[model samples]
Target chain A: MTGLMRRWLAHAIFALAAFATPLLLSGNRYFAFIAGITFFSVLWATGMNLLYGYTGLMPLMFGGIAGISAYVTIGLSANGWSFWLAMLVGSVAASLVGIVLGLPALRLRGFYFTLCSLVIQTVITLAFVYFVNLTNGDVGISHIPLPELPGGRQLAGTAYELVLATIAVIGVVVLTVIVESSFGRRLTAIREDDGLAETLGINVTRQKLAAFFVASLFASVGGALYAPYVGFISPRSFDVLLSLNIWVMVAFGGRGTIWGPVIGAVILAPVPFVLQDYYTIKDVVYGLLIIGVVVLLPGGIVGGVKRKGRADAPAAVAKQAAPVR
Target chain B: MSDTTLIILLSTITTGLMLGLIFSLVAVGVTIIYGSIWMPNAANGQFFLLAALFAWSTSVSWGLQPALAALLVIGSSVPLSYALEILLVRRFYDVPNRNISYFVLTLGITQILSGIFSITYGVWSDQFQLPPLVPGVTMLGPFPIANNRLAAMLIAAVLLAILFALLRFHRYGRALRAVFQNRDAAALRGVNVRGIYRMSFVLGNAVIFAGGVLFACAYSFDLTIAWTMAITAFAIMIIGGPGSVLGALVIGIVFGLTQAVASIFASPTIAAFAYLGAMLIILLFRPSGLFAR
Candidate 1:
C-alpha cells in the first residue's frame, strides 16, 4: 500500500540523516562526540520503547543491564579476547540477566512491577560496587582501548562515530521490522491486557520474556559500544538515573511510537553536554520537563498529536469510564 | 566471654536497636501513606533527606538546639505536606492506576530536590554531621554508645509507641483502618475518605521527617544517604507487606539487625546486597509480602 511505502520512505530519510550526522559533523570533534552520544541515547531510548511503550512494562533496571554488558565486554577484552567477540558475548549475557531480572513482571503489574524493577536496579548497582575486583569499586574503568580494525588501526574519532551511527540505524531498522511484525502485535495485545491476551491463546509469558531479551539486546549493544566510545565504565555510569533518562526520552517523545523516541533522543540527548557549564540546573530542568510532560502531555509529543486527531477513540473513552478498582 | 567479643556483641545490639527503631518509624510512615492512598512515594527518601538537611542547617548553622531543630522540622512537614497535597497529590486521588502516576510525579520531585541539593548543600560539603543533642557517651558493659544515639533511639521508640496507640485507639485511626480495609465500605459508613487520605499523607510524611532528623542526630550523613535509605525503607515495606504498620516494625528491626550484624563480617556494601537479595526473593515468592492481611 502507499502507506507502507510512505513508512519506508520516512525510514529511509531517517537512515540517511542518521548516517549523515557524524560525517557532516566530523570536522568538529566536539560536535561529532555529541552526535555519537546521541546515537547511543537513540539506541537506548528505542530499546526502552519496546518494553515501556509497546509492552507497558517499564524496566527501571535497563541501565543496569547495559552496565552488565559493558563490564563483561571490558573484562573479556582485557583478557585478550577480540573486542567484537567480547561484545557479542557480553550483549547475550546481559540480555540473559535482563530476562532473570524481568521474572517479577510475570507476577507484578504496572506500579508493582516498576517498584520491583527499581529494587532490582538498586541491587545490581550494589553488586557492582561490592565486587570491587570487577568494577574497580566505583573508581570505574577508564581509558578503554578502542576496537581494532582489520588494518590494525584503532577505530577512533569520526570512524567510531560512523560505526555508532550504523549500529543506531540498524537498531532502528530492527525495531521497525519488529514493530510491524506479528510479535509486535502480540506484545501490544499483552500490553493492553495480558490476562485477556492469555485467554485469547497468546503465550503471554513466552512473549514477555522474548520482548525482554530483544529489548535488553538493544540496551546491551549500546552499553558495549558506550564503554569504548567514552572510554569509561563506572557504576554511576549506568545507574537508575541512566535508566530513568532513557525512559524519559521514550515517554517524552511518545511511547508506543517508533519515530517518537528517536525524536526525543535527538532533542534531549545533547542537553547535558550543551549545559555542561550550568550543570547545577540541568537536573532541575530535566525534572521540570518530566513533570510538565506528565501533567500537560501524558501521551507525549507524538501520542498527543495522534490522540487529538482521534479524540473520540474508544480506548480513551474506556479509560475515562473505568472506575477505581 | 572475652572482652573483645563482649564489646562487639554489645555494639552490634546497640547499633541494631538504634537503626531498627528509626527504620521502623520510616517504614511505618511509608506503609501508612501507601495503605491509605495508593501513592508509593518515590520521593520518600528525598523527604527524609530534606528533614535531615533542614535539621543540620538549624542545629549546626543557625545555632538552634538539635532537639528544637528536630521539632521545627517535624512541625514544618505539616505545612509542606498540605502544600504538596493541594498542588499535586489530590489531583491523582481519583485517577485509576494513580500509583503509577504518583510514582512518576514523586520521581520528578526527587529529581528537582536532588538537583537543588547538589547546588546548595552539595557545594558546601560532601558529608554533613550534626552536633550531638546530648554530649556524653554511655557505657553498657564493654561497649560505649553515644548519649545522642541513645536519645534518638529512645525518641524513636516513644514515637513508634505513640503511632501504634493512635492507630489502635484514636478516632482518625479507626477511620483510616476502615478506609484501608474497604474504601467503598468506609465511604458507605460515613467515613470521610478524602479527609483520612489527607491526614494520613501529612502524618506519614511527618514520621519520615522525624526519622531523618533522628538519623542526622545519631550519625553523619551525605547526599547518597537519600537513595540508600530509600531502598532500605522500601525493602522493609515490601518485605513487611505494604500498608501493614506492624509488619514494618518487625521487619524493620530484622533488617537493621541484619545490616548491623552483617557489617561486622563483611563490608557495608555486602550487607546491602544481602538485604536486597532477600527482598528480591521475597518479591518472587510472595509478592504480597509476609504480613499482608
Candidate 2:
C-alpha cells in the first residue's frame, strides 16, 4: 500500500472513533457537550501547532483572535443573525484582522515579533472593552442565539454534540491535508531559517501572515463553538489567561505533529471538569503540569513517547514518507 | 485648548513624568536581561510583583520599616532569581530555538507566580502604603502633586544615573558590557561570561524588585498587576530602545504622560491603548529598539 493510502486509512479510523465517542457514551447530552468542547479544544490546539510549531511564531496570540470572533458572533446574533451566518462572519473577520495585524508584525523578527504580538493581543482584547458601542464595553452582549438546523430547531444536547463533533472531524481532516500540503513544507523551511528561506526566494512575510490568518480562523472557530456552547459571550471570556491556556494546550500536547494538539486538548479540557470540587487547585495543577511538561518533555508527550523529543520527530516522519515531497 | 485644559495637561504631564520614572525602574531590569542574555524575560513583571510583596511582607508582617524591607528584598531577591535561573532556565541554553523556549519558560514561571500568589494570598488587591516615606503634596506652579511621587521620581533618577555610571565605569558593568557585546570575545578575554549571565539575571530581578516596591507604594496591587506592569514596562522599553537607560527614562515619562492625557479624553483602558498604539508604530521604524544599547 502507498504511504498516502495508509495515512488516510489511519485518519479514517481516528475520525470514526472520535465520532463514535458521543454514541459510545450512549448519546448522553452532558457527555456530548464535554466531548464537543474537547473537540473544539482540538481545533484550537491545531491552530497553535500551525502557527508556533510549524511556523515558529512566538508569543502566539490566541485570545485576541478568539475575542475578535466572539464579539463579532455576539454582535451579529444581537442583530438577529443566524448562528451559522454569525459564525462565518466572525471567523472571516478574525482572519482579516489576523492578516492585517500579521503583515507589519511579521516584519518584527525574533523577540520583537513576540513582544509586538503580545501588545497586539493586549490592545485587541482591550479594544473590545474600549469600543463600548460595539462590544457593549464589559457588560457584553448576552443571550446570544445558537445556530438552527434545517428543521428550524435550535442546536442542543446530542444533536449539537453530534453536529460539532462531525464538524470537528471535518476540521481535523482539512487540517491534516494542510499539514501534508506544499504550504506546510514551506512553513517548515521558514521555521528552520527565515533568512535562509528568504535567500531561497520564499516570500517569508506572506507565508507568516498566511499562517497567522489560518490560526486566527481556527481561534474564531473555537470562539464560535464556545459562545453557543456556553450561551454567553464576554470580554472576560477572552482574557490573557485564556490565551495562555490555549498556549499550554498546544505546548503540552506537542507541536509540529497532527495528533499532538488533539491529544493535548483531550487531556487538558477535562481537568477543570474532573476537578470541579477543587476549583482553586485547577490552575495550580495546570501550571505545574505545563512547566513539568515543557521542562522534561519539551517535544511534548507524543514527541517524548516517540523518542524524538523535538521537531526532529516531524523530520523523522518526513524521512519515512512526505506527502508534500 | 482652554486655560483649565492647559493646567490639566501640565498636571498630567508632571504625573506621567513621576510614573514614568517608576516604569523605567521596571523596564531597566527587563532591558538589562534582554541585552545581556538575548532572552526577553517575560517574568520580570512577576519578579517585581513578588519583590513588592516581599517588601510588604517584611514591612507589614514582620514589623520592619519599608526602607528596611527594601534592603531585605535586595538581599534575598538576588539569590532567589539566581536559583530559579540555575534550576529551571539553565536547561534551555543548548536547545534549538531557545528564544521561544525561554519565552514559554518565563510564561510558565509567570503562571507559577500567579498560582503561588493566589494560593498564598487569595488573589486579592489591597492598598499598599509604604508608610508615607514622603508625606503631603508639593505644588508645581499651581498644581498640587503628591510628594511621594516626587520622592519616587527622585529615587528613580538617582538609580538610573547610578546604573549608567556603573555600566560606563564600574569594572563589573564593563565586564557585563563586554559579555553582552560579544560573549565569545568576552570569554576569550577571561570575562567570566557565565558568571556575568548569573549576575545580570540576579540584577534584573533586583531592579524589578525595586520597581515593584516603588509601584506598590504608589498604587495598590493584585495578581494581575504583573501583567499590566510587564506590558507597560515592555512598551516603554521598546519605545526608549533596548539597553538605553536614558531612552527608558525619557520614554517612560512619555508613556505616563500619554496615558494621563488619554485618560482626559478616554477611559483608563483606552488611555493604555494610546501608548501601545504608539509603541506599535515606533516598532515599525525600530524593530531592534528605538535606540542602540
Candidate 3:
C-alpha cells in the first residue's frame, strides 16, 4: 500500500511481462524477435532518459556511442576473443570515447551542445564507413555469429529473448536506483540550473562526465548485444536516426519519469515492424509524431498527465503574473 | 609543374571556389536564422535538397531553362518559409529555450522531407542532374571547365556579394544585425521583432534554396547529398561564428578548399574527416567561433 511498495510492484510486473512476452510469442519467431528488439529500445530509451530527463542533455550521438561499442565488440570477437570479454572491453572503450565527446557539454549548453553532439555522431558514422576492413564498410557485416553460453551452446531463440528481457529489466532497475540516489539529485539540480547548482556547491563538470560514462555504458552494452542479436552490424544501424528514435521514445514517454520511456519504447518500437508493408509512410508517421510531441505534448504523455493533476501549480501562477502585452 | 599537377591544381582551385561559394551561401542562410531566432534549423539541408530537386524537376523534366528553374525554386521558398514561419516557427518564438524545441521541430520536418524524397525521387532514379544552362567549355589556361559549372560559380559569387552588400549597407540588413545582437534591445529601438523573425526565416531559407539549385547546376546529385551538405554547412557555421556572415564566408571557403585539396591526396572521406576535425578543434578552443563579434 506504501508508495515504495507500489513502485516496486510496478517494476516487478514490468519484469514479469518482459520475460513472459518472449515465451508467449515463442510459437511465432517473428513476434518474439520484435519483442527482443523492443527490449533493446527500452534499454536505450532508459539510458537516454538519464541524460535527457535527469541531466537535461539530449545527446544525439547516443546511437553513435552504441555503434562504437558494436563495432569494437564485433572486431574483437572476430579476432579469436570471447564475445563476453569483447563486449566488456567495447562498452568501456565506448564509454571513454563518450566522455571525450561530452567534453563540449561542459561549456556549451542546450542547443549548442546538441549541435556539437550531432557533429560527433556524423564523425562516428563516417568512421564506421571509412574503416572498411574493420566495419566491412557500407556493405555491413551480415550473419554475425551469436554469442556463446557457458555450456558451449549458442545464445539464440527463447534464451536470447529471455536474456534481453532480463537486461531490459535490469536497465530499468538501475535507472530507478540512480534516480533515487544523491547523484540523481545532483543531476536534477544541474538540469534545472547549472549555474545555481554550481553556486550550491555541485561540481557540474565532474557530475556531467560521470553521467556521460554511466549513460554510455547503458548505450554501449545494449549496442554490444544488438549486433549479435540482430545478426548484422552496419554504420547505418547506429546512425543519427537511431539516436533520434531512442530520444523520441524518451521524449514521447515523458522524460524525467521512471516508467515513461519504457512505455514509449513498448508502444513505438514495434510500430515500424507492424507497418512494414507501408514502409514508405512509416517515417512520415514518425515525423508527425515528433512534431505532435513537441507542439501539443511537450511534457509527453506521462508528464502531461502529471501536469493536469497539478493544474494549480506554480507554472500557472507564473503565467498569471506575467503582464499582458 | 607537370601536366597532372597542373590539372590537379586547377581542378582544386575551380572545385574549391564553386563548392566554397555554395557552402558559404548555405552557411550564411543557417547563420542568419540562428543568429536572429536562435533556432538551429536541422532541416536546413532538407530545404537545400528541396530546392535542388525542384530545380531538377523543372529544368530537366518540365523543360524549363535551368536559370528560370533556379529562379522559380528560390522564389517558391518564400511562400513555403512564410507558411512554415506562421504555422510552426512563430509558435516557438516566445518559448524559453526555443532553440532546442526548434531543433526538434525542424528534425521532424527533415524526417518528413527525407521520407517523401525516398519514396518519390528515390523511386524515380538513384541520381539526378540538370541539363547545362549553357553549352560549351571554358578554357582557363590548360583546364577546361564546363560552361555550366563556370556559370553556376559566377552566380554563386554574385549572390554572396549581393548578400554581403545587403547585410552591410541595406536598412533591412542593419535591422537584422540589430536583432542578432540583442533581441530585446532591438525591440526597444522600435524594430518589429516578430516581423524581423519572419523576414529572416524566409530570407535564410531562400538563400539555402539558392545553394541547392546552384549545387544541382554544378554537379549530379543524389539524396545522400542532403546529410553530407547539412554536416558541412553546420561545420562552417560553427567555425565561422553563428551570426557572422563574414565568418561564414571565410570558414566556408577554407572548408571547401580543405576538402578539395585533401581529396587530391587521400579519399574524399578523408577530406570530410579533416574539416570535421577542424570544426571540433575550433569548438574546443573557441566555442564562440573564429569570427564572433
How would the candidate models be sorted by TM-score, starting from the highest? Answer: 3, 1, 2
Interface RMSD of 1: 1.1
Candidate No. with top lDDT: 3
True interface contacts reproduced, per candidate:
0.69, 0.46, 0.67
Candidates sorted on lDDT, descending: 3, 1, 2
Q: Comparing 2 and 3 by DockQ, which wins?
A: 3
Residue-level error in angstroms, candidate 3, position B85: 0.8
Top of the candidates by DockQ? 1
Global lDDT of each model?
A: 0.91, 0.76, 0.92
lDDT of 3 at A231: 94
Question: Model 3 off-target regions past 4 Å?
Answer: A1-3, A312-325, B2-4, B123-125
lDDT of 1 at A221: 98
Per-residue lDDT over A44-139 for candidate 1, one digit per residue giving the tens place of the 0 to 100 score: 999999999999998999999999999999999999999999999999999999898888999989988998898889888888887899889779
Clashing pairs in 1: none
Give candidate 1's error at residue A155 in angstroms.
Answer: 1.8
